[model samples]
Target chain A: MFKKILFICLLPLVASAQETIYDSFVLAPGWTKLSFIPPESGTYTLPTYPKATNGNVINHKSEVKSLYQLYDNKITLLNFMYTTCTDINGCPLATAVFHKIQQKVSKDPVLSKKIRLLSLSFDPKNDTPDVLKLYATGTDKQLVDWQFLTSSSPELLDPILRGYQQRIVKEYDENGNYIGSISHILRVFLIDQEKNVRNIYSVSFLHPDLLINDIKTLLDPKTKNGTVIARSAN
Target chain B: MKKLISTLYGMLMSAFLAVALVPTQAFSDETCMSPYMAKIVGQEDYVYVWTLGQVGVGDEQDKLVTIAVNPNSPHYGNVIGHVSVGGRNEAHHSGFTDDRHYLWAATLDTSKIFIFDVHTNPNKPKLHKVITNFVKASGGIVGPHTTYALPGRMMISGLSNNQDFGGRTALVEYTNDGTYVATYHMPHDENLYGATKTGQIADGYGYDVRALPRRNVMITSSFTGWNNYMMNLGKLMGDSDAMKRFGNTVVVWDLHSRKPKKVFDVPGAPLEIRCAWGSQNNYCFTTTALTSQIWLIYEKDGEWQTESVGTIGDPAKIPLPVDISITADDKHLWVNTWNDGMTRVFDISDPHNAKEVYTKVIGDQVNMLSQSWDGKRVYFTSSLLANWDKADGPEKMPQFFKAYDYKDGELQFKFAIDFATEKLGMPHQMRFGAYSLYAKSPKDGAKVAELSK
Candidate 1:
């Protein structure tokens, strides 16, 4: 069953890779080489914008949980995505970057235990708890804690989307029949241990190396309000 | 030779058909809007004109005038609606938030920033919030000029300070919900603020702000203060002491940290800054008001540099370039010269050398220019300042909003609305609006989603 679900998930990606026209749209820098060097980790500061709001969610293990409980005392990188988003530069790009970050974090003993990754789905009707569980199959054994979550209904999901300022519009056909596709501006967020949103990343600024550096910056002891719980290897 | 000629003819016909058959995207807005804001990729439904209330015009209050521009609508080429703020406050510039849900219009004289909800009803924007304590909240930084959008906040540039009302000012940051975040002062000769001054002068003046996120660089251009801007144009020009007080520096800063990195000496009051949109394009163009020259701020050899690329009209004539708009392709730049009321187009394919290709007189005094994304539609407004505007005469209307269809390198006049005759105030800055930004169809009563709070 796991193999079958994985095959179904990887099918669209394979087809998209074969059919993509290189010049059709500009690939964001997160998918390619970064154009410039980022600033040193602790030399700069990320001022808090707003506190990350909480919502009721069902983790991949079919257990009910509060978003704040998952974010408790952990440096979190949260992204909103649907399982079937086919836009190469949209959800797939974010998931790919998160995957790369997970791989890099796994190599670092300290960072692997200090950070948490959350992928929450706004399409509750489509991505149920079981769907998220299947999607999060291989993440269980990873050193870093990666959780895939979804709500029971649109009512339960709306507040989380509103809190994050993540806007998504559902597509429909000429007859007003629902299409599975959703349109949104991709965003990834970085939350500190205290649940304050430190940074927001759009397509132009979403890179794994940049995310890792920001994570290290938040954990650096020299930073204001930052504890020296873990040190990152550069 | 005959076979080759036939083949060339066939290729030419195919190319012409390809060009003729493809539909024009028409997806652009005042091409220099904040990149973080949502864009109207289709036809814009309305143009919101931030008007400076003249003493005897209409209600004698600064108003947000909505002009229906989409040709498909019944009210096309007409003033559909308007909402007047209480009184005249010297309204100058306005911008939208990152989500494009609210329009923040700032007044230079009173330092009042008015926020209007453009998403709830794109056709008729209602006053949402007003920040009346800008001077007190920003710690004496006065005259908010540019309201630029960051990720989740608005970064505003100031023209003068409340202490001395001089050109020295700072940039203030505010959350989208109207809470003040912080204030960053510009680097001056007295306080370098850890920024490297690469030239002889650091005037610490502020007018416009733009950013290149990939390079982590945010740039600000300088203009004069309230003392000179609010003065009578004729008298101020004659006063040598006031004339010498214009800003002469442009500062580059680290975008993430909000810290100044380097300051370049770009004399003669650089008012508007338009950065190129191309992924690889790293340069921005700013035209000087006093010098009548185009200055390019670009990165070269891992260092940000400034160069005077070309001249606008004639320097001796003092064309006074006030507003500039670059095309989405970054190939052409439209520069509006206020003194001569002429708009010149420069071919800037080569960033180092910009050459003028076309020029046209827009009005008696044109101060703002906005072009569409496809370079097909151009919009112009003619009001620099409430006191600086040219008086209305029988022949020429100094305050007006004009639209033209740009095709084949010529501006075919589509329509014009004379503000004085229509009883509307002097129109200064124009921003585009569309219903689609909020997931609503253009049709009336279309199902609209609740925008994020």
Candidate 2:
């Protein structure tokens, strides 16, 4: 019996065991940076920057229910975020950026005429529409023009984020505590009036003037733009 | 014309060799071929390597998955022709009968034993039977964590749960065909243990069931001793009162003598204890599922001397530390830790500082671990206890194996042990060598070097 077993087991051994392939890379920091890994360890990879899903809207918050009765046929600025996020890079930064975008867009008459701001929360738990409405509008100004939406679960949040090609995963300690590592897909989507995601702006490129130019090109097709999203003017 | 014919023949021969060797070498070299890998298996030469079929975790179809490899392929190791053992859940253990005939496994999801035949293979191997129901009537307890096969007679087993809490590590017996014979409830002092709310009382399914030179002793270490001093939870120590109630004691049951021995207790909880013939008498070495530290326990100077030697994490791709086996040579100690992502090897020649010489990541999450007679290549299976997706679930696809080059710390190969068409369920425990093919010359393994030089 043993001899028969050994004979049967040895059949696959004449394989030429050579050739090397290395699939190694550094674990980049943060999730939206598209470098989030599994609950376990190993290198993190962000899927191809997801093309944004536009024109879809639902009311997830209360007071902000009718915040903006009319959304001008303007280009929408898209940002993904989540609540229960304590890290500066997670939900806080996305909201803060949208807050800044709201201020900047409100001032630019020509830009505001054709563009809006959208901030979706990856964390559906804490960030109800009311909470998001409270969050988007700082103490001074209620950035009611910007919409903050939360999905039902990680399952729902996953596709929206992955659609926008964003990455996120729960962070844990040596003892397995669920420390939040909520993050966004760092790039802001510049969707045109057609609800088509047109331009990609890395997080660092989110300056107001630069964004103004990009919107100008998307809206008018011909104009003098800036460093973030500039047009040829021709 | 003659020259042309010879050339054509040579070309045909080379083409035949290329097609046959590519995939064979490809997977092996990628997963288990580094020179450093051989050292991990701790064997001079590998006799056999067979990848298994797909087996799901209990209810969880995803997560836990594995490929079983019998590197030392028994002297008579390939009898079943195409049947072997493997699974989807990681961090489980196994029970094999002597002579490598019957193999039994405890799954992570259902906490039941799955059985298989080792002789069922020529190249492709798989499991023939699964005894999903391992429950016996014993004081309202069910769910077993580990199993031990005593050849064709009856096998021993341990229980893991109750309605409110898990029950004692009750020892049970099973017939050769994977039938539950009877359960041997362990001796526990409820007064000392308290009522179990989730095995929260004073005990749990036994951890390690080992046979020593003198007799059989199954060691039980409450679950609380396994995780970060039970750090993740709000409380310290372990999950329930049963584990804490036991006070981190090593519960030993001598099956032969029918005697129970609470030999030693660590300041920390000890989950699993294995007894091997050390240079001294049967020296029992144990790892604290609680501390990640290994302890050397032996009776000396009229008392048990427990010495701290080394440290290791959970099994590769698994969530908790589990079944461990010391090589026949005892020079190498192999441990399967929880969610650790790799199988660790310790050179115990110097037990004082048992250096981690090498490691090999097993498939998905590792449940139980097994070894070829030579101990060069180690085999691991999956279990659902460590959050392994239960068997028959959608997520339980693409399960494979973890082969290490014993010499180099690298994966020798990872083959899809999953055979899609057969619909093989979760793999559990395994034993190698149902048939052994003799060498043509029958030369001594040591003669190659002497004769050549």
Candidate 3:
């Protein structure tokens, strides 16, 4: 018991003596120099990429004098999409994920106050401000803080797309018939009051429970975490 | 009577015009920041950094860094700055576009984007008037990751929002203005629920989608995160391409043709590769992550000619390799480990028959790794916050960033940041953007002397 206690005390010291900087490759807890990660599943604190270097915002949505003004002090959830996107998997899942987030958050009033949702249009011409407002509210204003946004034309939104690293391009088939489609990836960003990306998730992969739990973690001030994922609001 | 009526009409028209134009002009004039281009020094210089896990959101969302070393300037060493963007909560990857003035940051959260003006004040950079964030269909948002810039001011983000079917993926596109032009969905993979209780999630997800030079070809790899994260591991809301290797599928698409050109049966869940745009513009040469092997394939005489240049994962236990990068010289390909802190460099001069040249052990396991263009020094970040979260003071953080000498396998320097010291929000995502071919190595991780209170 004494020896075990001593080992426990020194464990952190030993761990602190050495460190790993890159996850792309590393030594396992019980390994010597280098080893390959096995083809198995495990929980992890996934690493994130860097922010946009150029400091440019894509002007895909309608040119609002100040898009940020659209949601003043509200914890807004902004989504990305184009008008010609037919991929249900990309756009539909994103909307569905929000539906899931809404279902879970509606019950928790405290959590809901700081949270608002908005969808930013990838296509400006078709996705005008009117179209976005109509699309987000569903003509009923079902969602209180939800808003959809778009820019004037492609030029205004170009830098914004590059800044986000969200790929956007014209589509043409073999015969050159404009597919009239815009292809993009799908994920929802959960922003905090300070406007930091607290949590990000692929729409389809986003489990409503997971999102709810994450919001709980962010809303609560007690969670001291280097990589906090979620909490049970219930 | 006619004169009096005409004069009255003119007066009314003038009054109406005054009311209409003032408000709009006032609002527009208040803030009209524009995204400007950062003057490029060296040839084809680009920056590399760790993007926050967001499609694009706040301070940490659209943030990007590059190592700028211009001998003629006051701020010549590593330049740290960022631009704000509107999009998802997490950005996927960041790179340079259009004469190095525009920075491209892809998000893992939403498809929102921005083109920041890094050319502004280097120290405290501000974005000029940029693009507007895109609004997805009435329903949901999509995920966008890693990008490749083109000459015609084009960009591509490999995608996977697999919901109904097997990791159905798409190729999202945008105009140079940061607007959503259109989307190119991958051949419908409609199989998110290969095996699940909630058929809403797909078992597969396409990952590491990247663009290669030589016109139209783009590549993507995928894995089945459903069974691993959802079923066995219970990662309800996460990337499904975390576990397993068999799901490795590399899809190469034609940009101009916009057709599913061909799908290569990758060995494992391919991660990243160093496809240096050599003298040849027809094909891309890169390394696959999940498989721990080097794959070289190029379009020669129409058909795809392929070959495995090198091997990484030990055949005995199948140790998988993670990230790979090519030196600025385009002479060697560097491969880093995922489970172990080991790195191997291979000579890819001859794309078909590459060989491991350098090997070294650095730490327990690194989360991210970066090297100078010349490949003499390496910079990386710790996988966990333990290093920084537990510093000497009450609210202290260990050095989140570290530097090492690759040639001698020496621990040259380490940086320990203190929330109490710098008084800045704990510094995370330490990255080097653009430096000259052989930029002077940064002063090793020696502790910066604390300022006198």
Ranking by DockQ: 1, 3, 2
What's the lDDT for residue B104 in model 1? 98
TM-score of chain A of 2: 0.60
lDDT of 1 by residue, B1-453 (tens): 436533543454344333333332223335777653455555677899999988877888999999988887778899988999999899999998877888999999999999999978888899999999999998999899999987667899999999889899999999778888788999998987778999988989999999888788899999988899999898898999999999988999988767788999999998899998776789899989999999999999889999999999889989889899988778888899998999999999998899999999988789888776556788999999977877664235578899999999999999999898888888999898877676566665433322211
Using TM-score as the measure, the top candidate is 1
- Put down candidate 3 lDDT per residue, B1-453, tens digits, no spaces: 436533543454344333322221000000001111121212212233433322111232334444333333433344344443432234445545533445555544444454555433323334544433432531222445445444214345444443532344555555344544445554423521111212122223465555542333555555432223123222422444544423455566543323445566555566654455332434445555555677776666655545677888574454446556665435666676645666677776776777887776644344456664334555554332222122244332222344554455333553332212322222233323332111111233221111100
Q: What is the lDDT of candidate 2?
A: 0.43
**Chain A TM-score for each of the predictions:** 0.89, 0.60, 0.63
Higher-ranked by DockQ: 2 or 3? 3
Question: Candidate 3 — what's its lDDT?
Answer: 0.43
TM-score (chain B) for model 2? 0.59
How would the candidate models be sorted by lDDT, starting from the highest? 1, 3, 2
List TM-score per model, in order: 0.90, 0.43, 0.46
After superposition, the stretches of candidate 1 with alpha carbons farther than 4 Å from their true spots are A1-24, A226-234, B1-29, B392-397, B444-453
Number of colliding residue pairs in each model: 1, 140, 150
